[model samples]
Target: MFRILLGREGRVWREALAAVLAAEEDLEVVAELAHTDEVPVVAARKRPDVVVLDHALPGSLTVPDLCEKLGAALPGSVVLVLMDQRGGALSTALARLAPRVGVLTTDATPWQLVESVRQLVRGETVLDAKVAVAALTARDNPLTDRERDVLRLAADGAPAKEIATELFLSAGTVRNYLSRVIAKTGARTRIEAIRIAQASGWI
Candidate 1:
């Protein structure tokens, strides 16, 4: 049997995944974790052959970061990310981490999820066609790369001063980027701009 580890915050989804995996003849869920912070520990203990992760966890860490870390920690393991249909950033980040990992949409049927997991176990990357099309059809932003970077930092809940410090720009420059992002996204406030940029997959 292929051992698997599951990571997701939602109790209902976790239960559903467990039920689906349990019914598979060749797959076994060796462990399940609720938070990204617990993933490393659980992985170290379980040493599963595959890890199915949810991308909507509450933390500063992104799915790509988790995949990178897990890849390092368990060189023989494969990471498969489960993302919401509208999770643009998650899709972009997973795409960037391709070949090392694969992505599946939450709307996927149980059979699809099991098949994706099997594909990942065979060292193949699988991306849902609808999710791929959605990513391609997302709006392209007019903001410069630096402006997008600033907006992403803001979306991660970083303050303007911290963002400026991290980007090595003056606070005023950070504010200017925020203003440009707001205007490009047609949002009234920085928070709204961040949300819009994230939703459009610009960041």
Candidate 2:
């Protein structure tokens, strides 16, 4: 059986999807979660073959960052992300994850979901055609590459000092970059800036 781990904030939605996947003869749910923060930890412990995550799962890290973490925790496992109608803020960085990271719309049938999981486990890429086209044609990134670097670290809950250290810059410079990011995104705060950048697929 293929060990599966699921992460979605909605109680009803998570369990319902779990039931659908579990009913399949070749799959077994090793773990289920309601928060993105729990995914890497649980997945590390369970060592599941596939992890299915919802983009809206409540947590500090964005879906892409969380997926990176999960990948590091279990390099052999694959991820199948369920995107909302707005394409769940698909990004170029995400597309780079390729076969290790599959994408599907939330409206996909239960059969599609099950098959996608199996395909991911079989080392096949499963990207929704519509979302891929939409993401490719989306607006260009507004922030500079440096600004995006800072915001990406910020999205992962890194403090200004930590971001500065990682980027080999001063903390004040990091803060300045964050401030510019917020202004460029027309956001009221740092978190809002990160969200705007993510939703716009800028980072």
Candidate 3:
């Protein structure tokens, strides 16, 4: 049998997913979790062959970090992530983590979910067609880590000096980073760049 563990919130939809997989004679729903942190402890005991992950699950680590932890602990286990948006940090970073990762949107059909799970068990990678195209066509996020940090603080209405004080950098250096952020985002001003980054899910 192909055992599955669901790591997600939205109890109603998750249970509906369980019902769908339960119809398959060779599939079993081993466990369901409301948070990402539960996966390590609960899944360690169950040793499920697959895990259905949600993008919003809470943990001390980020989504990609949790995936790495699960991948290492579960050995041959794989993940089928229910994507929230078409592109974001999680989707962008996925390729670097688990080769067996399956990406799909919440709007995907039940049949698609089932097929993806089966493909995962067969050691194949699955990505929704829309996700594939968006990920392929999306512009590479241009902001570096420090640039993103400086811009994120700026977005929160922090003045350059306050940002520099918080990050332990000189005021002039903060302005330079802000200028690069504006140019990279093709925005007219810092506020505009912040809007672009927030809209693109980069900050």
Highest lDDT model number? 2
- Local distance difference test, per candidate? 0.79, 0.83, 0.79
Question: Which pairs clash (backbone N, Cα, C closer than 3 Å) in model 3?
Answer: none
Q: Write the per-residue lDDT of candidate 1 for residues 1-203, one digit (tens) a residue.
A: 98999988778979888889989899999987787777888899999998999875533455567789999999999888887666554576677776668888888888999998889888787887766776667665477756766776788788989988866789999989888888888999988887787777666
Worst 10 residues of 1 by lDDT: 55-64
Better of 2 and 3 by TM-score: 2
Candidate 2, which segments miss by more than 4 Å at Cα? 143-182, 186-203
Deviation in Å, model 3, residue 116 alpha carbon: 0.3
Please give, for residues 1-203, the per-residue lDDT of candidate 2 as tens digits.
Answer: 99999998678989999999999999999899987778888888899999999865655566788888878878999999887545424545567798999988889999999999999999999888866875786677778756777887899899999888877789999999998988888899998998887777676
Give model 1's TM-score versus the native structure: 0.73
Instruction: Give lDDT: candidate 2, residue 119.
Output: 93
RMSD of each: 5.4, 5.9, 6.2
Task: For residues 1-203, write the lDDT of model 3, one tens digit per residue.
Answer: 99999977678977988998888888999998887667889989999998888865644445566778888888799988887564565466775553578888888888888888999889887877766665665567898767876876798799999989866789999999999999999999888899888777565
